[model samples]
Structure formats: structure tokens, C-alpha cells
Target: MASTTQTKSNSGVEKHADINWDELGFDLVPADYMYVTKCGKEENFTNGNIIPYANIAISPFAGILNYGQGLLESLKAYRRDDGRVLLFRPEQNAQRMQIGAERLCMPSPSIEHFVEAVKQTVLANKHWVPPPGKGSLYVRPLLIGSGPVLSLVTAPEISFLIHACPVGNYHKGPINLLVEDKTHRATPGGTGDIKTITNYSPVYKAIAQAKARGFSDVLFLDAVTKKYIEEVSSCNIFIVKGNVISTPAICGTILPGITRKSIIEIALGFGYQVEERVIPLKDLFDVDEVFCTGTAVVVSPVASITYGDKRVEYKTGAETVSKKLYDMLTGIQTGRIEDKMGWTVEID
Candidate 1:
């Protein structure tokens, strides 16, 4: 195995004490069980497992290792007030993984299969799902090539599996991002558009450099112009000016975040102007507000953004518009508000 990690548990099943979401920085809680499946030869997928959310098992010959062929998806399971668990628009994640699989010449899992896998996990481990506002289970679905081959060409054998963790938000404090104009996350015409493991290697240096310089994360710029803001290390960036909300348009280079789409639609539904257009890093300095969206942090504020030596700051909390959106989004997720869009699917 590349890195043998033992689960911090007994019987290989995680038996966590009722988690303290507030102390964990989690506004939500994690569910207990997880669903998984595997792909074998002959375009066949054998029955997977419904394992407890504790440890992971993988083969040393898993295609993700020697050749770097894999994709992953992340989503949350919200626990509603009526003692029900719901999932957001998980179809998008499945569709995205299908796209990634096709591009890598691997087999794709059926949407039905994907959704059922998720449902099984949430239903079995419903107790792990923290309260609506505390935190929720972080579901991760992984697809990797598993054929026993050492060739250089694309292989037909692959495996699709799912795992979960009771992670709180990535961080609770305000986020400070270092803008690395010279360090690019993904090159144009590269696998930047796909959620492949290979896309992460080139940005390790930029991440390390930013951490050493007192920044919590790195913001990548365009490889060519270096003026347009692409994305933060783990999330998509946003700009708010007065009543208008603007985000970087999708150009097949950055991760198409489900949370980003939800926030944009929510803004529009609130009668605010929302624009998905090309945004420059310079525009953020003059904007009324700045935020980042992802499955982890949901609606995290940008306290300060730093370029080579220049820095800009912002203010946001429960009173600001940023906080309003955060509350509304999380409220809808946790069942505080009515889910008019039918974005949530009850798991229990």
C-alpha cells in the first residue's frame, strides 16, 4: 500500500462519542454508515460494501497509484428538523464523475447506482449525522482503475467506491488567501477541468509557499494572463458589489462546484443580480464583499487576500450580506427554511 493507515477504532468500525459540533467548528454533524462498490474486468461492477465510517481498504495495484487515474466527489447529508436526513443535488456530482471517467477512458457508474449507494450509507448511519446547524457527514465517492496492468495506455478495468468522514468545516476562522500570480494551479488545455488526482501535483509548491508565508490558502490565476482569478485551493471565489453578485464563469479549467451553483441561484432567487462572467483579481479589492463556496466551508468569508506583497481586507459575519446568505443556505440545508427548489432528498 502507498500509505497504510489504520482506523482509530475498535472492530474496524468507528465508534465516535456523540460529537460536539460547536467545539468541532462544525455547524453540522456526520452520519454513521457509508456505501461502496467496485468495478472488475469485463465491464462488470461487483457488489460493494456498506462499511462503517472508520478505515479504508485499497490495493497497492489500484490504478490511482502507478498511473494516476482517478476522480472523487464530495457532498453533504443534511439532517432536517423533522428528524429526516436529506441530500442536496447529488446528481450533478455523479454526472461530473461520469464526465471525468469518460475522459480517462474508464467505466462510469449508473446514476441510479450512485444515488442508491449514497442513500444506503445515510440511512444506516443516520445517528452520525449531526444536528442541522452543527455539521453533517462528508461523503466521498472515488473511482479508480483496477485492472492488473503496467501498460502506458488506457485500461478497461476500474473500480468505483465510496467513503465518508465526520469532518467539521475545513476551518472556522476567517480565511486568508495568498494570490500566487506566478504559480498556476492548472495549465490551459490540461486536466484542470477534470477532478483527477494528477491535477493536484503541480500546485503543491504553490500551496507550501503560501503556507510558509502566513497564508491559509493559495488563489490561482490564469496561466496565460495571470490577471484573472481562477479559484482558491479548495473552493470557488465570489465577489459582491452592492446588489450585484459576480463569480468567475465556467471555462472548463476550474472545478464546477455544486455549492457555487447553489449560492448563485440562491442570490438570484433573493431578487439580487447575479452574473457568471469573467472576473479579475483586481475587481475583488473594490467589491463590497468577497467569499468562497465549497462542500466543506459552504460560505466562508475572505478576511484578507494577498498577492506578492499587496493585501486587501473585508468584514463579514451574521449581520453582513455574506452572513445572510450563509444563514439562508445553511438554513435551507438544515430545514430552518422551506426547500422550494426541492434540492434536498430525505435520506431517512
Candidate 2:
């Protein structure tokens, strides 16, 4: 790996030392450049530009610091065998961020501007994209209220920025989940469906406690009923039974994951019956297989789940539905398989 001091010019690509792709974890390995743009109350987004990856100065009393007026999106850039870079469903992420901004009363980039900024950032740091079959360059786009404010109100100015990092799996190996009976991830009339910054920090304590108890992740239930499964702390959950696959419905309580949507479409294409409905906590005990989907952890198999006194375990490893979905999804992403769904956008 190269030192962080290694930089790239906007007009030319710089080749850094080879990274140990297989050994890559989900840590942030900084790239050479980032995209930044800003907007005010009276103006749309200005033409963005690429700059060296560094921190920005913000006011101590910024609205993002006080009112939690921020949103984020996560997508990945993949390297194919032929040395081309591909982005998977970035438009979906852009659209989701737009909706999140609307809900949070923050300004966001348009879909075209968001996609272009992502592409520019990826291209500027194309050398950081991992090799095929190894990992990907994780792209994170953030929108925050940068202007200072004392009272509880939306900031007049907003900042949109993007950064890329070479990364691997978010959760390693088969995972064990702890069902959270106490903490609630989202309520019915709250900011549950959006990727707002405030929605994540509230669940840190629950996730930390679960990890301390030797669980891989915490599973959250609905705030009102507590009997129906909503989602995991960071990803969406699904269960398989024979030829049928089902996941909890996106009923304004769970974040609509891009990978979850892709998996549902791909499963339906394979003639598997797919259903999106409320999944009672009791249903997990009788499921044949269980898994999770997200941007960071593409697909992860669930080995066991602990809910109160009842502990349910499932079979994981090769030849499972999760394995198939992972293979198909990654294949399409890396260009090993035909992309019939038009989900991938290749960079020139």
C-alpha cells in the first residue's frame, strides 16, 4: 500500500502501490481526492470541483451540530477484469438522498449532479479501486447544514461532499444476531425511512451492548408493536423457506436498502416467490435460512438469533440461498455475468 501523502492530479491518473485486496477490511483507507459543492437559500448547487481529501472547517454552532440536519448515501465502485470501473445503482441512492433531504428540511444535489459528482470522485481516485474479485471502492455522499445557527431552524447554507475508500466486508463470517426487545430503531411517525445522520447515532448503544454480549449485530423490532421485525441496526433482514423468500415490508419504519431491492428483483427472476410483509419475530424460528443485505455487506448469512429465552439457529455455508444471491449479485457487479437488469453504469 502507498502512503497517504501520495496524490493524483485531476488531468492524469496516478498509480499507487498495490494494496492487499484480500486482506482489506471495512476500515476507511483514504483516497486521493474528494468532490465538494455548496448551496445557499437563494441558489441551486454550484458547479462542484474535486479537491484533495481533507477536513473542512465548520462553525461551532452549525445547524448540523445542533439540529442534526444531515443526510448520507453509500454506494460502491467495482473494478472489472478488463480494467473498467462500474457503479451499481447510484441513481437509486441519489433519489433516496433527495427524499431524505426533503424529509429533513435540508438541501441536496439533484440526481444528475449527485451521479456526476460520484463519478468524478471515483475517476479521480480510480487507482484506489480494488482489483476484481477482491473488494470495491466505497463511495459515501454526505449532505450537512454547514451554516451556523443557535435556534432550532434549518441552515441557510448546505454542503454536499463525497469521499471514496477501498473496503471489504462490513461483517466477517456468518453472524449471530441479538433481538433487541428494549430499544426501538424507528417509530411510525418518525424519521425512520430516511438516511438521516440522527437516525444512526441513537442505535449505537444497543449495537455496542449486543457486540459486548458476543453477538454480531442487533435486530430491531417495530417501536409500536415490538413483535414484528423491522430491520437490523445497519441492514435489512430476509428469510427463506423452501422456494419462497420473504422480508419485512418497507412500511416507513425500515430504511429501504438498495441491495434488498436488487435481491427481491433477482429472486423473482429465478422463479422464487417473494413477499414483502410484516414478519413476526416468531417466524424466524421456523425459517429454513436467513440473511441480511446492505451496501457494505452485500449479503451475509445469519447463523443464529437470540430472542429472550428462545434461541434459534440456522444452517449456513455453501449451497444456501444467501450464497446463490451473493454469487449472482457480485457476478453482475463485477461484470462476470450478463447485466440484464441495467443496474450497472460503467465509467469511461
lDDT of 2 at 46: 69
The prediction achieving the highest TM-score against the true structure is 2
Error of 1 at 185 (Å): 1.3
Question: On residues 179-263, what C-alpha lDDT tens digit does candidate 2 reach at each position?
Answer: 9989998999898899988889999999999999999999999988889998998899999999999999988988999999999
Q: Write the per-residue lDDT of candidate 1 for residues 165-256, one digit (tens) a residue.
A: 55567866788999888877777787777778777777888889888988888888988888899898778888888899888888877788
lDDT of 2 at 305: 98
Return the TM-score for candidate 1, rounded to 2 decimals. 0.88
Q: Candidate 2 regions off by >4 Å?
A: 1-14
Candidate 2 weakest ten by summed lDDT: 4-13
Q: Pick the candidate with the highest lDDT.
A: 2
